[model samples]
Target: MARYVTGAPPPSLDPAVVALLEKAETATIGHWRHWGFVDRRVAPLLPRRRVAGTAFTVMLPANDGTMLAHALDHLRPGDVLVVDRLGDRRHACIGGGLAVAAQAAGAVAAVVDGPCTDLEEIEEAGFPVWCRGLAPVTTQIFDMGGAMNVPVSIGGAVVMPGDAVICDNSGVLVLPPGEAEAEARRAIETQARGAETARRVAAGELRMGVVSGATARVTGG
Candidate 1:
């Protein structure tokens, strides 16, 4: 047996705020010591792609996917679906059809705590998905019920609906709505500094360790 929990609609991230986050990489943001990142194993299905949007979280029961379809109705363009599989990594509750539906609904990406099926079709649909791994075993509509738009844990981080979700080849990070704007601004500045350092290095004016201050920190000089 399962239960479906419903509540008021969660807030959405402003498009400008989403754009700010999209400008920075997860690794850069994580460097600031934000711990909302999902596990490294949950990585993008394609290489060199990134996703930044508000989270639309779902909590599914083990081996059942009754609520996923219902969840799609709430998606908006630039929304990232974060699925918590209730620690059942064995079952892949998402597949090609769901991916298509998500894309059609304007979801930018999906992050699943468990495995996923239909990698080929998901890729074909150009829907970016992050998951533990690939599995031929898929879940069914058990009608057992699940939860949506609630706080759920994925990859050790509590992701609530409306939280900012940033994903790339590096990994996924969940930013609380309250912190998203400030953190994005910080990450943008860091990215600019990094770009300058890279340029200096390319011009043979700076060494990697020297530019990063690692040499000075270690040599004590």
Candidate 2:
């Protein structure tokens, strides 16, 4: 087989769509959808930061980072590099250099199915990465066959190049472009409603159980 298998970069999501999705928290979305969430094992390096963007995906070989460079080369603004490590959680293919490179290419963030290294450099670069964890061992440009801009799995979530990637402290969520807009809109409305409920409780106009419906359910009133 060829040393590398790749495809053209998928179309990017509209910036307006991205803006809408960014404000919609994954936890809020979780209340409605049963799927499309990345495994909890994969988490954010900076939990406080939230980002939304188009998925620019790559299937990286277990210990080879050759395809990563290609993926970076093609990354456009507002893209998130979603890496499938082929189940190699031991070796980290992403580190300081790749983080900086991808950020310079206008990537909003990256999601990896495995570990990553160079924590100091990555933090210094101020890039957000959702990954398994930190590792001392790293991958190399071994030229093993890999693919870019194609469908891949991250944390058991199937991600495509054009998918909508929303990530934050909670976890990473991938959604089809068409579905993303509606989901984000719903989540936003739900968040507003939730906030209003919290406000009433804080104002002493309602109790916690009353807000949650537990009071009625328990009292049968």
List pairs with backbone clashes in candidate 1: none
Model 2, which residues run further than 4 Å from truth?
none
Question: Could you tell me the lDDT of residue 31 within candidate 1?
Answer: 83
Q: After superposition on all CA atoms, how large is the RMSD of candidate 1?
A: 1.4
TM-score of every model versus the real structure: 0.95, 0.96
Cα deviation at 88, candidate 2, in Å, is: 0.5
* Per-model tally of clashing residue pairs: 0, 0
lDDT of 1 by residue, 182-218 (tens): 9989999999999998999999998999877899999
lDDT of 2 by residue, 21-131 (tens): 999999999997989999998998765578999999899877888888877888999999999999898998899999999999999999999999998899999999989
> In terms of TM-score, which candidate is strongest?
2
The regions of model 1 sitting more than 4 angstroms off are none
Candidate 2, residue 97: lDDT: 95
Q: After superposition, how far is residue 5 of candidate 2 from its true place, in Å?
A: 1.7
